[model samples]
Target: MAKTKNVRQTALEILDAIEKNQSYSNLLLNNAIEKNQLPSKDIGLLTELIYGTLQRKMTLDFYLKPFVKNSKKTERWVMNLLRLTLYQMVYLDRIPDRAAIHEAVEIAKKQGHKGIAGMVNGVMRSIQREGLPSMDTISDPLDRLSIETSHPIWLVKRWDKQFGFEKTKEMCEQNLIAPMQTARVNLTRISRDECLETLKEEGFEVEKSPVIPEAIRVLKGNIASSRAFKWGMLTIQDESSMLVAYALGVTENEHILDACAAPGGKSTHLAEKMDNTGEVVSLDLHLHKVKLIRDNAQRLGLGNIRAITMDSRTAGERFEKEMFDRILLDAPCSGLGVMRRKPDIKYVKQEKDLTQLSSIQKDLLGTMAPLVKKGGYLVYSTCTVDEVENQNVVESFLAEHPDFEGDSSFKERMPEAVQPLINGFDLQILPQHIGSDGFYIACLRKKV
Candidate 1:
């Protein structure tokens, strides 16, 4: 049997992985816990500590600034120790301040000298005596948001510019918190009710979503490695993502092209929506991703999906013009819409990536436009809220392809709460407004 690494130690390793190298917090954290054979309770603690520290990094540093006069690399372990302690004090309600301080001091004593340990103890005690830094004292709106919400300063600024102050702050706060585990019911195998019954029998808590019929949101638990998921009875997907395939309104025997499809979540959902009867050609730029699509489809028992490795920009070269009854161009974008799930994108993504991505989106839309059959639907979707990538890309595509027009019936298929967001033809799901992942979907029809 493997010795159990302490949760804090596991968290430290994860932070080191994220800081010293190129590793995603979610993936690395999951891998670390699994590899080390940590207990489930310790796994929870490790997750909270790692995610809390990363999410509140800016805020933690800001609070620490008052304690440390100058931000130099002095006693690195002490800094991380304080950060972990402060994270528990501020965010974790169960952890008492005294316990947090004691843990910090103990860790400090092990890692550094008595002087550094004393400093760590002093800082935590001071924080416990006083409290978190006041968000009001910070005059700069972006800086204030960064401190209050624990997002990076650069990310706060970008969101502030894009979404304005209030909306950006809300979005930042939302990202700091853990997202709910949402799953879409696999209709090809079982009905939503039947799936829920199966889940209940397997000792999983589930609640049906009021907004989406086939969407079920799992409350506060891990289901990624569950037998239900492995058997393809449920797919780990966001509620907003579930809407994408449904937005396409695919029917049985329809020829659908999922341009830029990979990891096959939406493509598989589309196949399920078609009752596994239609030919769903799932295309990806990379062969590995194409295999991923095939793997997902195979696991789900979705036989109608055909995974292909091809650049969507060259769709005309591969397929006949106007051949597909439905085409879903879920283009590649900055991935800003999924910041809640993948927080590191906030740090690494550049504004220049946007321009390049927008170019790719336009090229993809242009190439896939001719593939949609006359009177058939073509849905363009992106997990981004940027105007350039969402509505503007559609506008530019419509400018070039005069034979295509926006499908007005899209609103009819959408939930009541999402109806008003249907701006003209394209639906822009804002992160702040919908409590859903930031997404943009446009339904269009090829004119005969």
Candidate 2:
């Protein structure tokens, strides 16, 4: 029997890898793209198909709910096949409906029995005859958001309760569309203007990010595997993330500590902001992560960064108290902020994960507090908007440690538009409010 190969087939394989086993979407997609030697256009389609299906799983299931009952134990392969067809039928304009149905049946026939193929074809034809499921059918706001936006009900309910219904809906809808690939200009290599000129020369269109001076949003196309990116003219980063290193305000010859730094984006940016003249000790808990930081620094030609494998929770014990002039605690959290970029996060992260991560964040913040010298700066940032992991954690930390206070200087450092969000030094950037990723960054100072 001949095997069929197409974007849909590749997407199904990737989904199976993610569901039956534990596989990162990015890594699996990269491997598949490389192994298949797919054309650039097909590679793009494969990414869209895989990500779109995963991103809208709940919604697709909602549409399929009436078609099949007692679905709790349905075979995952059948479910994924139906979802893939529905994804193309609904989202992709280029792929014709009849073609989508035919491809789906072929895939089903290859993987399952004639009965499964019949079921797949029937359901898709029904959808093509009728329109997609209506929002009115689902009365519960959370359930409606879940089905409409293809997110988990628990997440929708949580957001509705925390951020109001309108904002919750907006967040869910925002995650469906692709995120802009933003990058921070490596001033050490080229100025922002110079980087923009270089990118334009390479046939890349870019627009300056409104939030950060050094960040540029890629408006027209992908730059992940481009020659300019390879040459280190820019590093892909969110505008909010680029602010963390800038908020640290590293100066020449100053000692800096990036506790919990991994993959070293912000740490390398800190070194760059310091003009590569200061010492930036970048530490991560895992050895592999340390290597990642080292690789990023090497690629960017950042010599000022020293990547180390260390647990940040005990940074004060290992490093001298008040030794660093500046410290950045890019604490790990639920990663709710970047949901638009990584759709799998909403499904993978649980409520318990946030609770457990908050405790660790508190401990790490406490342990790293003393590492900053008297009057030195400490920046605490997370890629999440949950109050438990954002404001509440910082408030609790300040209550426990009175010697450190929120630095009002952060307000002065932030752009005028962002300063109002600073409730006396704490900043919470909402996902929908800002086009950038939802990030919470607070600048604290140790009393002299």
Candidate 3:
């Protein structure tokens, strides 16, 4: 007899792997989808189970704590299965609670022995009967907010300190919501209007992104399968991400460097902004990722991109000083900003990672500083809202290097909606502001 595949089982496997820090949510999901070749309905259900459980993990844990008979005896898979079931019971209105419980029991029995199955059934039935513990019971304000929003307590404290209570709460709440699908039009290949018409013609439920003129908000349909995407007319990207090339004040025929570029979203945007007239030398550490950049550029029909596999830290050695007209260091980050789209990120990132990543970000910034030509823009960006990785890194660099000053042209450079969010020369875009990913971008100009 052949073994049957189920979304719950696959979800548990991926969730367990995430707990062990094996791979990222997006990467794992894509791989699993391709491997199983499941129907579209099952794919949607699988996606919902994994992301929903991850998004409400802490809250689900709080609900399960009073129900589980023995914590130490429980296997990680059992715990994840329970989380998956409970998440559906609480969050997914379409799924009946009893149906979710019955599925959990079946999955538990198949994955483990009868004892495990009984335990899972007992816990789930009790949850359905007794109702979850009251949020009011968590006396501490921060503790309550953390559980309610399913964020870590330490992170809540840190963000509450950095952004104040109201904003922190809003950001945390936003993290649980599903991110909108948005894509950028490759203006180099086709006008945004033409791309919009093409996407509409392809039956995509889409509209122009209010955030950026070159981007569109996708309401329905897969952009990957659309003819416009295949024809190099569009690329799926976040509205905030679409702003990096603008922050550079990129102009036609200007040479650019995209340090730490992988998958080349911003690198391609830079090239498009330059109308494919000048070189956009993109660098990454891995050969496969360099190929992703090349593939994307090729798909977009952009010929000005030059992708190479090399550690971005070593980029200074490979290029002469003051070589590029502008440089983009979209540095590696804790990825706390994109949590809405990838809930597993909150679980994987630790506070210590911030300090470590900050050091690396500063080093990358320092290394690439000399490569930006006189008066050229050095646009430092990250998909994170943490102060240590954003402001502190840029501020420290500016203090140590007086030859570079914050480029306030970002006032005119960014879309008007984003100008007021600017801080000095940098902007910290909290995810709640525009339903976009939390992002930080700072423009610096090398003093003439």
Candidate 4:
């Protein structure tokens, strides 16, 4: 009979799959953990190993290069084993170096030859004795920041140029930190205070967001597994994202268009803010995603949302021009801002992706712009910090479409703490500032 793989072995396989197939790390890890039926403790270890190793891939490679000569020539599985083992040694202080090495050697023997096992044992010992090479040797500031933070050098350079050295460094460091599990309370069902009291009664350490009233930050416990979440009293979302509904400032019984809406977090939030009385047309490009939006709405018991599988670029063709009272173009972006939750994005996204995504964002904005009725609100948002995709796109749109003007009054609807962050109609929420996903929101109003 084939041997049952241990947690380390399972983690190595998942990492190997991520490297070989370029699969999403979170999805792959969750599927593997469920398939193996790992215990809670082992599950935690597996998660750390996979995410830590992938999050610091470049740094791990840099540290391994001095020890493992011809690393490129080594088998991909062997290299991943080395990377994950080294990650435990350097970052995870709870696991002893000896135990980590032992596990790696055993996993190596089962997966590879005796020679690979011996090499794994030897390299880990060498790393323990010699320690890692100095990062100070990297002369270029951008290159050093990239290695230290395990972000792509090109991305670091781009951020450096845009946000300057200190802010770029802070953003990179923030990305490496694990994101808090924040959820927006289903205000249509329960008030924020009532939800907090219920969560506290259930022994969860929960706190209301200072900025977004409906947002609750789960400080401890498996929030998704709780009765509150199962009953759809809460929807997992970042505080920054929850603010998009507020930016739209919808009224009761108003018509709202959530262009490019999928999985329906913002759409549901819009419906909740409108007291479940408004019509929220949620559109996505794929049928599967439209179903996902519908599922979320059904879970939250939100009847106001209508999920439609249609491309945002072709929104005007299906809907009457200037039909909606409010239009939200939460454009697809490079996803640089949410890297804390999705570290794999740093490796997968390229420099050219920004230009390509910006073009798509602008096209979506233009397509959805006409759908906002006169005296209606239009809000453009992205989960990216890129200037071209956020500010530049809005600026270019304003230049061509003179009918819409920046709406500064949106700030008045937001928390006073966030009011200072708003410059005219645009607000850029950095992850470090709000301890949430980085987001850019721009509010515009159609001329009456």
User: What lDDT does each candidate get?
Assistant: 0.81, 0.84, 0.89, 0.90
Worst 10 residues of 2 by lDDT: 1-10
TM-score of decoy 2: 0.95
Cα lDDT of candidate 2 equals 0.84
Q: Clashing residue pairs, candidate 2?
A: none
TM-score of each: 0.91, 0.95, 0.97, 0.97
Instruction: Give a tens-digit lDDT track for model 3, residues 232-294.
Output: 898889999988988987888888999988999999999988888989999999999999999
- Residues 1-448 of candidate 2: C-alpha lDDT, one tens digit per residue: 1223477788899998888776678889999989988888787788888888888888888888877655676788889888888888888898888888898899899889898899888888888777777879778767777888877777788878888999888877877777788998888888888888878877888878787888888977777666668887778888788878767777798999999888888988888888888789999989999998898888888899998888887777789878999999999899988877777787888888988999999998899887889999989999998988988898999999899998877777776657667778888887776677889998888898
Which portions of model 3 miss their true places by more than 4 Å? 1-5
Better of 1 and 3 by TM-score: 3
- Lowest lDDT 10-residue stretch of candidate 4: 1-10
Kindly list the per-residue Cα lDDT of model 1 for residues 1-448, writing each as its tens digit.
1222367766776776676675788899879877988878788788778877877777888888877755577555556677778888888898787877776676677767788878888887777677767778989877777878766676677767777988887787777767778888887888889888778777788889776788888875677767878999888888777788767888899999999889888999999988889799999989999999998899899999998988788889989988999999888898888877777676677778877899988888888887888898889899987777887788888898899998888888887767887877778776766567889899988898
